[model samples]
Target chain A: MEPERFRELLDAYGGEEQRWPAEHRQAMRALYTGDSGARADVQRARELDLLLDSYRVKAPDLTQRIIDRVAPTGLGRFFAWLQPTVPAQWWRPATAFALPLLLGVALGLSDGSSGASTTVIDWELQEQALLSVTNEEPWYE
Target chain B: MQRDEENELVRRITRGDRAAFAVLVGQHQRALTNYTRRMLTDTDLADDVVQETFLRLWTQAARYDAGTARLTTWLHNIAHNLCIDSFRRSSRISFSDDADSTLESDDAPDSAEHSRERSDAVRQAVASLPERQRSALILCHYQGLSNRDAAEILDVSVDALESLLARARRRLKQLLEEFHGA
Candidate 1:
């Protein structure tokens, strides 16, 4: 790839890709064939990739304490523990049944002739969303 | 039935089945923490993010749509959002022009001469990458997520992932090459 195109990639990929522009991908992919000329460039990129891989930190230990504090040992009792600190209404679990029932209905609807037009609701999005919820970072969702 | 399994687990948890939720947490904790660590570059923040992630899961278990996506995807979505949230919460600058030049460090994780040399160079190169690029690369290259998956986790498109990855690689090579030359 030319220096100009390379620079464009830096500018383009430097930001988060969740909202990445479509045109940039088409343009970049066209030249990403690992061609002879691009070989050198890609080699350099790969080297960086390997190095970055080395630096990637190991995942933290997922012991019981971490899990306990996060998920809480018991919802009812835990919320009961928090009764003094938080509102009592917050612990109610109405949505637990309602939401899943609604989703189940959606799943049932997903089986009809309209399946072709229906979005699969890509697993990728769900993972992202749940991760967002789990991590307490609602904004990313 | 992965989605089905996840949804069932969620339902079980909602019914006050702590064991069911523990199973989910057990399944996801490592991946979630690793992804957060890669994104935040801070152990504490990663922990906080991971904790927040599960907390959300505990609460949102009901709202989750089983047919919409896989349990893993839902989990990733939670962690990704928090990473971004923590990133913004702190006033840390996103990139450092001087970050690449400081490739020297005394702490080394590898013992072999060749391993030490290369790993050290790579470590510095990764540390020097502009924060976002470093996060992107760590999750994709090191954490073993696909570019598309990383992009989704980071809330970017595949093209954007390639772009960030492309630049991250370019800068990493440039930095490592400089370290070796020295």
Candidate 2:
């Protein structure tokens, strides 16, 4: 490596050979071996590296706090259990089919497809229908 | 953690396994915290960013591609992006007022004091570097990431990352010299 190139790398990567780009390590070592000026530059870079090392980071552990926030709630956990463990490709077609079916079910419920006054029992039936549509196995016998 | 193990944990996590998520957090917490602290210079802010990063991991585990990058690289990428968002939110990066003290065990009081002063100077010098340069240095130097991985985190080419590292070192040396003649 040329002197200027060596200095540029020394400035960027510091004086540590391990930190230097693998492609140039042999050339850099050869240059440092033969050149006093290159050695001096490396020494200067090492000084800066050591100085930089002095600033050690001591951070607090926030593991549980993070975990608490991300843990699934009861409802989310229920849906999570329903999610397929198969490769994601299995779900794409399922989702495409399920979305239109869900929309149709919503429309039918709103339209009062039974042609009679809707009641609490009707709402329960609608909920069950939506749940059954979402999962392969029926929610009711 | 090995990539295969991490992949397995993530696979389990995708299936809503709390145990797997906790395991991932345990593996990366210290390294992520240390990287964030060095990048942001505030312990509280760094912790918040690290938390956000893991939360994203929980939500976005399906999006991660192990073939594209290691879990550490992916985690750092998430943390790095959040750090950038924080910079934008605050309209500027803030430097910590307190410099970190060295953990040397010295018998002589005077030598310890001198060592502390030098360490303080170095910390301030690093904290004062420009954002890109500081990120490049911290990812490659303190985090022990390879140049290619650090480059990916910074969204820069390896050559560009190297340029940033060089400039950071040059500026750091100047800053240290001005701070304490070190």
lDDT of 2 at B4: 96
TM-score for chain B of all predictions: 0.73, 0.89
Backbone clash pairs for candidate 2 read: A12-B166
How well is each residue in A11-76 modelled by candidate 2, as lDDT tens digits? 889898888878899999999999998999889888888877766767667888877766565456
- Candidate 2's residue-wise lDDT over B61-98, tens digit each? 89999999999999999999878777766766676655
Best by DockQ: 2
Clashes of each: 31, 1
- Tell me the TM-score that candidate 1 gets on chain A alone: 0.33
Q: How close is candidate 2 to the true structure, as a TM-score?
A: 0.74
lDDT of 1 by residue, B79-159 (tens): 776666666666563332332222233454454445556655675566567766877776665555655667776678877
Cα RMSD, model 2 = 12.6
DockQ list for all candidates: 0.14, 0.24
Question: In candidate 1, what are the lDDT values of residues A1-141, reduced to their tens digit?
Answer: 465675455443432233234446545445555455543554444444444444434564665754465334464445533322112223444554477899989988886646466546689988998888787855747
Output the lDDT of residue A3, model 2.
Answer: 92
- Worst lDDT run of 10 residues, candidate 2 chain A, spans A80-89
